[model samples]
Target: MAVSTRTSSIGGHQREPSGTLRLSVPTSYGHKRVLPLLPAFRARYPRVEIDVHVSNRSVDFAAEGFDVAIRILPPSDSSLVVRKLEDAAFVVVAAPGYLRRAGTPQTIADLQQHECIQFLRPASGRPLPWYLHEDGREQEIVTAGSYCVSDDVTGCITLLRHGAGLLQTLRFMVEDELRDGTLVKVMSHCAGSARPVSLLYPHRRALPLRVRVFIDFIVEKSTAWRRAKL
Candidate 1:
């Protein structure tokens, strides 16, 4: 039997892009979106080694040595290069059981009657306002509820999925549930608000080949993911 062996070089001229890529991403986004795409990225750039740090807090690029970072919100550091990857769309959703028991909310004002789950901001410990895009204008609704989750957004999602209450969350996080009828979308008229997800890296004269390809890869994939959802 004859087997073929592939070399890392093409005709002994160009070497395959190879190096360790240190990445930091939020826990929920990392688990749901970024981690799933890694197998394909690895298959394409087999020689590249990826060291991923999953956390919700900001990291110091120089201190942490992270080559790239994915952020759902804008990074405060002005020194690092920032590139907007995609808008993480948000939707207000509830488990069908919850909707059935609590009654579905039909208008932005109707949310007042429903048990809206709140996600508290880590920096300020204040509940994040629900951003609703209605009538071609964006409005921030200060929502209050008996239940609130902090630090990790996934906790809010868990409570929502179990029929605890309603939640406004990234569309990608609840896509499967929305499709499977486990969860149902409410307030369709005001569902277009989105959070910009950006990529961060240190400013350098020339980015390493491995980092360059990864940036391109993620941007491409994110575009496709957004289009599919649309």
Candidate 2:
């Protein structure tokens, strides 16, 4: 879609008209990876205004009138167009104090002996599963801990930082702390599964100008961001 670059004046003030874009994104560690792009997006398209709705539950983009939604897991519905943005690796992390106090787990089996901070989705009462990969094989392990909280990224990180049990979180969430030694990787050899970050939009014959522009921008910037991280 071609967007008009013509500048217009509103209320006697010369300003570009802002195009509103609605997005529904999952509230998870993955959001920490994608949310940083908003400033750059706004800088590039100053006329675009974005409204982000954060939720762990799947949203009906078409039904809810959302322009697009970014999700770690793509929707199963065939009517939506899904674009894979990047592959993210998950890791098991614990605060330095927690590891010093509880001792670090040397293997996947050792994890059973440590207290694990579990994430329970508020929308659904089920606890998130920790999928670990070791020796070219994958295993889904259900972890148990004394502390259980709703799926909030900040809360989980805070709990982990306060010497809570092992947390199975996306690498993107703790990259800074991991580099600075605040949080330590528990199982280096057992790098967990990699999940794809995807962009989902309605499969319309002609996408709105604002939606098309933002989608293209995200695809371009996401590719560059992923490449730079490598």
Candidate 3:
């Protein structure tokens, strides 16, 4: 069945869109990227109630009954409607103190001498490889860390701020830190990897009005922001 959008009104006065919107988003990205934009969304659709779930793990929309899922990586379900939103570029960063003590890595080989902070999967406890591009090609290097953190990307920012070690994370998350000289981008010449961010929802003949408008609102607004940036 299609969920039709209806504008809420009081005493025949025209009003904004009204409905409940369930949105699932990743922890770090949601706070850094999506959360700030939501106030605009709420203002546009005044009566719309949003239930946002922030998690470091994935949510199964089909079974979990989520109206939408915001993910950094590509959507796993091909049948669902997916919109590619951002490049979500990453940078290898570290506190200046750490770099001063351990020395900055100029290349992948140099990383072996530094304490590379690695992020392992919370569920599987497996260390993921880092993807870097340099010398005209992309390379995947198995990473090891003296200080290992599991699951959360935001944790990397916290640790790096304290002069922990080198960590590769989404650039947007650490923009303030980078700009304020709290963290420094290391080996920027070799930093060329990013994940695709997407808005995911199950396929249906008729999309919910709230979902439709929300997607359009954010996508259009984000496009404009990027344009202004360039």
Per-residue lDDT tens digits for candidate 1, residues 1-230, read 43112223446576666889999999879988899999899898899999999888899888878899999978888998898878888888999999879898888888888888988888899998999976789988887788988888899889999999989888889988888888988887897577889999999996877888888889888887778662
> How well does each candidate superpose onto the true structure, as a TM-score?
0.86, 0.86, 0.86
Per-residue C-alpha lDDT of model 2 across residues 1-230, encoded as one tens digit per residue: 54443333447766553688998887763367557778877887787898888877687775688999888865788988899888778888999898888898988889789998888867677787888886688888888888788857668888998897889988778878888888988786785888888899888986766687678877887776577441
- For all candidates in order, the CA lDDT equals 0.85, 0.79, 0.80
RMSD, one per candidate, in order: 4.9, 4.0, 3.7
Clashing pairs in 3: none
- What global local distance difference test value does model 1 have? 0.85
Give the range of the ten consecutive residues with the poorest summed lDDT in model 2.
Answer: 1-10
Cα displacement (angstroms), candidate 2, residue 19, comes to 2.2
Kindly list the per-residue Cα lDDT of model 3 for residues 1-230, writing each as its tens digit.
54324443459775556688889988887888788889988888787889999987788877877888888888767877888877778788999999889888898988887777788877789776777886788788877777777767687778889998888877878878887898889888888677888888888896767887888776876685344321
Residue-level error in angstroms, candidate 3, position 178: 1.7
Best by the lDDT measure: 1
Off by over 4 Å in 1: 1-13, 134-136
Cα error of candidate 3 at position 119, Å:
1.0
